[model samples]
Target chain A: MDLPFSTPAGPDARSAFEASVMRHLDAAYGLARWLARNEQDAEDVVQEAVLRAYRFFGGFRGGDARVWLLAIVRNTFYTLRAAAPAPSAHDAFDETLHGGEDGAPDPETLLARAADAERLRAALARLPAEYREVLVLREFEECSYKEIAAITQLKIGTVMSRLARARERLARCLLEPAAEASP
Target chain B: MNCEEARVLLHAYLDDELDAAASLAMAQHLAGCAGCTQRYRGHARLQQALRDPALRVSAPAALRARLAARLPAPQPAARAARRWPALAAALAAALALTVTLATWQTLRPRAPAGDALVAEAVSGHVRALLAEHLLDVPSSDQHTVKPWFDGRLDYAPQVKDLVAEGFPLAGGRLDVLDGRRVAALVYRRHRHVINLYQWPAADGETGTRERDGYRVVQWNEDGMHYLAVSDAAAADLDAFVRAFRGASAAGAEPAR
Candidate 1:
């Protein structure tokens, strides 16, 4: 039987991989948790992503290991979502709407509600995954537009627009209590 | 830039993704525009809320252990290449054989009753500290930490609040040792972290050993095998063991 233990770096590679990638487990889990919106599925996503990263460690030619791992993490999330569709599969919110629409509350209302972490978390959770992921990468993870683009595999323009729309929806969700019932 | 244009570019400008000229233009607009400035503040506030540490949770220690456990063990072939000097084919073959035997001696299964168990318990404790993943449910209250094991483990491990005993309960997590799942309860003694691993006792034996500068104390109580591992001084660990054993004997339950 042929053993597939032919990676050049050997045991040292395992240690090196852990040193580089394991440190980012929290970040990876954070992203997965937000995207998957549950502890169990988020764990599954991280586990699968870590396995894929381990398998492809030989090809990992040095870059931001967090970004590299998160890219894999997000792709794993989408793949899993597709294979076993989530109950809220369709992201119902309109992505095209720019900042202002009719009856949009003033930013001050949002500012007040945003101070409440529970409300902020709920509003972020209510966003379409598309918007939520970008906001998470940009705001929570503190990734650059370029980094967000790289992780999400979208153009920098798309990243900016998605972030804009995400923030708008978050503002709306915070202000209008009625928005909670829509989904 | 007009209000319309400035508002449109607000996110990009705030994100610092704008070019110097556009950023300068946006800043120039915001200086004169109060409405836009408040809007900018709202966005900043929202971002600040998102940055709350409570928003992001540390990955559970069980998940971390699971990932670490799955990584392939180091193969002997790699070791042979590193240490063996290039020599005649016959000499290389002999060296390979020698290396294989040495590897087998190290890798071969032990009785799973002595050094093997201690080694695993020590490794789990060290990994928790090194990875900085000491807790899955980080709470000082034993009530909070104890119930966390429900549905996650087959049996609920007795969680003792050693706070009054000076080793305060930090939290609890699930870990696998000797190919069996065990509950690792975390405690702190000033700066030192103690991981007390417990599962149903296989056979009753109590002992203490020092390995790699970390002290391991093993005991069987109430049909549970407990291994308390930490880098604390031997005397401190012994004190911890006495306090823990004493607390267990007293049937201490802290106010539910």
Candidate 2:
């Protein structure tokens, strides 16, 4: 693919870069928001990501601008998150996150209750970041599996399995009562 | 595809990521097996819930402005070229005149009916922003916003709360569109405010159009016509519409 900005980071190149990639700001922010789970942290991550993207703009071989920008956003989010003082609970692996068929509600009841936005949000928030990122990329941003794999840096097989596990965990969280569900 | 294999492929199938032959095989297995079908339905419901627009967050405008300010100034070469003072001044004059003419052509009321509606919607959006009159009832709760529109207009506008989907129900107010009072529900996506104008459906037009840096997404659902206007990204506006429509379809109860 033709690189839109081959000039030496000149005015024309800067405009070309902004017009091409900055349009995906929402996509970048959305991914960061889901991963960071808050506005302030998400903003910090996106700010850093944009700077990284701008610095690397000259080297960017134009393909899918959204995906490329999103990959950088995801990487930036993780880098900042790692540098933060405390690791969030979302990073921890809790055995309770699994959905067991033990005394599970019927599908109709489960679906009806899960449709509630608050319940769904709380459930999603409880997922480990790895699981949450895949679900967010797939369902919210509507990225294809290939795009998700590209952004997350996971093999296609790993992406598929992680998504499966993520769905099961989310459903489990949704099915259980809120009080017990808070891990 | 056995239940084991079907279970593994179900997510891909629901996501439409499976190739046709694999998808067909999964579908065929699902058709015969009630257990897998029920599982598929459960997973499908979960997927649908995950698509709630409230789940996504747009970049705040403040962030965009901050980033814009931080960007290094470009085009030293362009500045150098400006050494041709007389020629540069002439070019600038020509550019200004061209801009004036373009603005005049757009601002003139020469657009066809459909285009006129789009322009009016855009104007309404800009007017709300400029006048600082975004809402009469500024509440995030849909119950408050929905009832605020009652008896204010001839038709009842379907109000759906999308706080969970990302756009919070900001409030509702009355706005004039096509010289008739319309119900305008306000929703906020980060710093951007989305003004959704609605009234009894007329037989004129329905689609999306861009005007003056804002997007106007017009559509008819049930008995009312809707024109959602926002300076938010075009994709965000489209998602807002989808979430609005989905929330309306899923239930009348506000997504808390």
Candidate 3:
């Protein structure tokens, strides 16, 4: 085997790839977790994506592996969810659930940032699934309209519309509560 | 420009697909129309929000190493492992058609769950012990190790050498720890295997806890954190950790 796919990087590539993955993995995991809604299932999705990325890594066209991984993550979620047992959606185990009235700032980001920071992340965590994926891909993943189209298999226009709607939902989310509180 | 035109152009403008002239027109319209401008601003703010490097989630050390070890393929092995059971079942069924054979042995053997994740890291470390694929970037020097990982990994892992204390720097390898490729700086202390896994910390940022009877230490330094797992005594690990940290601080060659 050419070993193009095996991860043991040149004693050096290993650290680089690990760092890149860690930097991006949580966002990938968070998105996967939100969409899948179970810790084990989300981990399963990430592991599956990691494996797929490994096997066909020879085909990777190199610009920003994070973007590539994010694409794989979305694909992995749908693929695995289709094959696996479905979980009850939005069962609300945690006080700060996705799409709930309020969502927690992912502790990964919130732990280190300023006090006022988690507001947007908390708002983001509250977005409905349909809106969250688009926002995550377009916003955090930095995927182009075309890339989002390919990842979601939607028309470019649909990607655009959904992103605009995602932003609108977030804007509504951010503005509505503050307005209500201003009395 | 009308709402129809602005609506049509909003995406193109946000996506940077518009020509210079059309972009200018969109900007002019965006300046004149508050609602559309807010929409544009919403898109812009949301776009900026996504790019925040802070928003990127760090995969924990355990998860990253786990990912790295299996990066080329984790699930497929499970799929492949599934076949042995079917094969054994077929063999048993054929024997039963003739004269029933003991079906207990038909249960195919598979690697246990915990072993499965640690296989590559342990085996690779052991193999390096045997064959010496250790340390492409050789040097216990933190300066060397840090810069060695500069273009290699996303973050720098702490590297140190405690040769005086008996653990000599054998080498380092880029292996997946928790599925993310990370630095696995190898060391030798009288036959006990040591694997130090370093990757950015993520949502799984719970504190250091003992895993499967192994002494594991995790802590943050500068902007990154590291987790080192070894079957060796905690004192030895701490000595190594102290040496590593001290070396990193002194700007000397870290414990190899």
Local error of candidate 1 at residue B58 (angstroms): 1.2
Query: How would you encode candidate 3's per-residue C-alpha lDDT over A124-149 as one tens digit per residue?
Result: 66666666787777666667777777
Worst 10 residues of 3 chain A by lDDT: A91-100
By TM-score: ranked, best first = 1, 2, 3
* Candidate whose TM-score is highest: 1
> How does candidate 3 score on lDDT?
0.56
- Residue pair clashes in candidate 2: A11-B75, B53-B165, B53-B166, B54-B164, B54-B165, B54-B166, B55-B165
Superposed Cα RMSD, model 2: 21.3
Best candidate (score: DockQ):
1
Q: Candidate order by lDDT, highest to lowest? A: 1, 2, 3
TM-score attained by chain A of model 3: 0.57
* lDDT by residue (tens digit), candidate 2, B122-196: 655654443234566878877677767665555667888788899988788776666565788888787577889
TM for candidate 2 is 0.56
Candidate 2: residue B239 lDDT (0-100) = 98
- The residue ranges of model 2 lying beyond 4 angstroms of the native Cα positions read A1-8, A94-99, A102-105, B75-256
lDDT of 1 by residue, B79-194 (tens): 32353222122223322333343333345666356877777677667545432345779899877888888866677798887788899888887666765557899887765778
Greater DockQ among 2 and 3 belongs to 2
Docking class of 2: incorrect
